[model samples]
Target: MTSPRRWTLRTENTGYTVRLSPDGPWAELDAWGPLGVEDGPSALDWSRRTHFITPADAAPAEYLPYGLRPFAGADLVASRPGEERGVWWDFEAVEEAAGSLRLAFADDVIGLRAVLCYSTVPGTDVILRWTELTCTGDRELRLERIDSAGVTVPVSGPARLTYLTGQWSQEFQHTQLDLPRGTFTMGSQQAVPGHAYAPWLAVQDGASEAAYGVALEWSGNWHMTAEAEPGGAVRVRAGRVPHEGAVFLAPGETLTTPRLACAFSPDGLDGLSRVWHRYERHLAGERLRRPRKVLYNSWEATGFDVDAAGQLELAKVAADIGAELFVVDDGWFPGRADDTGGLGDWYPDPAAFPQGFGRFVEEVRALGLDFGLWVEPEAVSPNSRLYAEHPEWVYRIDGRPARLVRNQLLLDLGRTDVQDFVIATLDRLLTEHAVSYLKWDMNRPPTERGRPGADHADHLDLDAQHVAGYLRVLDHLRAAHPHVTVEGCAGGGGRIEHATLARTDVVWPSDNTAPLDRLSIQYGFLHAHAPHVMSSWVTDAPGVFDPRPRSLAFRFVNAMCGVLGIGADLRAWTGEQRAEAARWIARYKDVRDVVHHADVRLLGTPADPTFGVQYDDPAAGRTVVAALSTGRLDGAPLVPGRPERLRLRGLDPRARYHDAESGSTYSGAHLLHYGLPFAWSADHDADLVVLTRQ
Candidate 1:
């Protein structure tokens, strides 16, 4: 009964240890030194008590180990009697065994360092990639790779220095490195510019469950640009530069990058396209915008009691089933919503829109669609009105009063006027309506609160300073609504990160609108995110609580793999289910620019009875396969083969094709050796094979 050894690494002189072998691969490492003994006798006070060791283990009442300082041009150089000399340690165990486990520390002359990686990728959730560094002592360094759910990828060239940070957990989280251009002066003070290392990474199924490792994807402020080559050498480029991936460095050399974290177990999309090609090569030179209105919601369709003409009649049946955005979930907000109460009162509920929310955003933009709203804005409702006009903005413990879940509380996002009233009430509802989209949500689970004198094992550094004040209220709503479009709903797949997808584009993912639970939660959120940021919809077909009707071609083959929403109500379907939901939302708006920019291939197994295909052809030699079937078995009769002759991978394999779903086509070697008849049914369902190349 022991197949779980996935990973482990260890080191010490006051720090370093990692272990994860509960069920795959293998990892175990340990290094140690300083423990106790100090009696004040010269030799630099017995070499600072044999180079430090004061961690007696306690912290973790919900995590708060923010302590370890010395990485900003780290220089101690030599110590023994308990070691501690320039300090160096590194760790990584990610061949996508649910990507995570990256420990690092650096000393020996400044280049900033204090990083952490902790994802446990099961259904693509888990985050923590916090960073605060400042380096440029010249040896090359640049890394802007933020993941674990807050997407920012960009890593420029030349980096080689390794491991810094000297000391251990005092409830960790205090960083300050300025590296004014490097030279050294920690005695007369002035040398405070670059060098601060306290690195970490862990995701070999990160501690397992708790809804998968509590959010983090390179949390907050990541930027390191340096250049001073030719001898004193210092060349670095890190990414997320103006929004695109980047990485470049030079020191002792070691940069393997690509670890967004994933795990579906029932194993499908396994390693999900190498964690979506390391988050699309750290968002390789950005520019891919597409979310003016790609939706499908229904609180799972009619859950909280819908209303407001039953949600404008399900936004005119999701704009006659083609939908271009029409949200409206949670019974139209205000003190006492259907779910219970208007969580954190963002307002709007003159009896569920008796004319207001700008006339329900001009009647869902006069039926052409394009209006969305559903906010949690950090949470409040203890019968709200901003918690009865600020009950010290929530997050308590001092006098106790702060424990209520779902009926709600939370809202003390480490206060800065509660991140300026959640960025001025979501920028006054995107400047009084015409709202383009928001969703947002957060639900709960941060618990109690402590940081006012810390010690309750330091409430996870005040919950990472209220998740860096909810990313400074989403960088002030993307600097005041850069053309709306939010999404990001926690409590439903909880805040998947890369720092909340660099201020969100889309997420929602789970209210479980059954298309077989979104084909196993979007094959585990397209393994680390970005199948047009996955949202998925089409609800209310015998799945209000599992009656099992399914089919609408297995719910548009799992809402055509995402960003398509329609929470059923189109005046109650049935015109052949509204022409098969407007012919699969017009074939997902004609292959959504190759499913929001191509390159994905899975084929089968979420527990294989066989039926799971996903191929995309980005222009040059066109191709697109989707197939499905994890149901039918034993009755037999469902066998339709012809992936033309299937064997395509990244395409252009000598072009020449044509089967935009069967006009008879072949080549790319007869569709990669003729193997594509996917017939495994509970009445015949699931298929999406488009191949073009006249």
Candidate 2:
């Protein structure tokens, strides 16, 4: 019998060769071509290549080079090229287990070292240190620098870093770098035009200045490769400038670069690291159980008019429907019994629940469902208690009141007091209630921008500061809670970044709950992220919000591809509708393990008239195929003729399987090589086929 040698790795660049051995501790890495080669044609000379051009010639200096320098305080000298020009510097690697590699070089003019460590996960994390020394008239000088430039600088300085550490592929490039998950560029910078600098220089009055202003730029990219074994092939290419880092040396100064480190593992330690962060940042680890599947929410059902009895009624229906979680969405907080009042107050509204929130939570738990509460903690209503108490906490314009979004004001998360207040409030809620899940929400953009107690002229940069503060708050939450499953919601899908994903277990794909709408959106999202990270939920009655016939089924099917949950009122569903939901839920329960763990195959592309998603459940020895026809010819038979047989992938050919829908039998070879036939009509645009090995 031939053992499964199903996965293979290759690269486009011939300069590198990767060897995989089952017994080797790591895949072998051999030198590939002299990539980034310039036969006098520099790497920066990509103007002739259409793929390199941007909509504008001067692309924003989003990408930059950042590194660390060692012996920052030392002075070094170099000889001229050809006349013993090269200078040498020696340094020792500290904590090799930290995974950093350092290299140094020196010449007649300058001495330098480059330390680089690529992470094994999806995110940016490259640490660099650079040091240089020069002498003038027998005087020695030392230079040290760390690239902590702000994001506005063309060099990105770390904000634009993409999460791409891990087994990743870029079209023809393959890679298996040992990268830690969630590692991302923390700082970067790019050279601004008309401001380039040349390393050649002289010293005057204690300062050694160089000629030629060079453009320095910095940007971060993400990567995920299919290569897992050692010696896996990968290719990388980057544009170059007129000169890399070159330093001018006086007679006797030495320079050093910062030490670099990175760790990689086949056990997915990087991903686990990010998961640990997500747990801590979102306070999910403290809640020992995974979030429940069937969740009932009051967003559509109650809106802002939620009373104790109203909540209890919904709780009863949720409990009866076997829903595991019930969330009291918007309008629960102080002065918020209606939409007009109470923006920032964290206290519960007395009118809505006369008995208080603790009693309400007890009542809900008594009905056999866990309680979840919604909080737009980042936004404050104009009439909220907190807003009244600390109006200065809201972002406001000079001599102007704060602008409102959805009748809310963006909270100033930059202040330590603000962060501490939010943390304390959340901690109180978690400690006081049986809250298992949190629908953490952000409803507004930063508008008014003023530093508290500062004059109107001292306004802050709202955008950058707010974004950074949001990350800080998320980090604080995760560190503090560590037990609750936090659901990130940015008015829908606005904040879908790798950093956000690293801090939260699930993200709402969008407020557009229609299954058809979600299919493509989810597809686009999955292109860069894992499917399990998405939270796809059912919401509202079909015609009320969505006018599609199979709205329910469509939502269910779309959500089946990700984490499953419901946000609508089950009590409003008829017996038949409830039964259908129950059946679908059971079906999900039957195959969720496989769907979550299996390798996915996109059978058809959107560019094609038809779209399909297929999953091969190796553990269950089953395969499920889902297809949707976007455009169909009129008068086409209800069941189209000669259905295209799909050449399925990611399956074991030796396994025998029987179709769940048709009882058709076939081996993996017959199913994958020959393909499966799917019949459908224009009205019935979507179909699902499941095959289980018998």
Best by lDDT: 1
Q: Please give the CA lDDT of all the candidate structures.
A: 0.49, 0.48
lDDT of 2 by residue, 1-694 (tens): 0112111111121111222212211121221123221122221212222233321121111111221111111012234433433233333221222322222222222343322221122222212222323342243222222221111111101111122111111110111223222221211111101111111011111111110000111111111111111111111112111111233334454332221111111112222222222222232232324533566777877788778898898788767656677888888876775666675677777888888878888999899888888887777777666777888887765578666667777777767678778888888888878787888876555545556576423323333344456678778777777767778776666454445666777777566665545565566545344555667777664532324444455567667777777777666788877776777677776666556555566665544545677776666677777666545546667544676556676677887778866778888888778877755454455666788877
Instruction: Assess candidate 1 and give its lDDT.
Output: 0.49
lDDT, candidate 1, 220-308, per-residue tens: 22233332222222322222211212233344444332233321111123333434433533442232454435575656567666557
Cα-based lDDT at residue 400, candidate 2: 80
> What TM-score does prediction 1 earn?
0.35
- Which 10 residues in a row give candidate 1 its minimum summed lDDT? 56-65
Task: Point out where model 2 deviates above 4 Å.
Answer: 1-99, 102-117, 122-292, 337-339, 454-468, 540-548, 606-610, 617-620, 629-633, 636-640, 643-647, 681-689
Q: Indicate the residue-level lDDT of 227 in model 1.
A: 27
How do all models score by TM-score?
Answer: 0.35, 0.63
Position 53, candidate 2: lDDT: 32
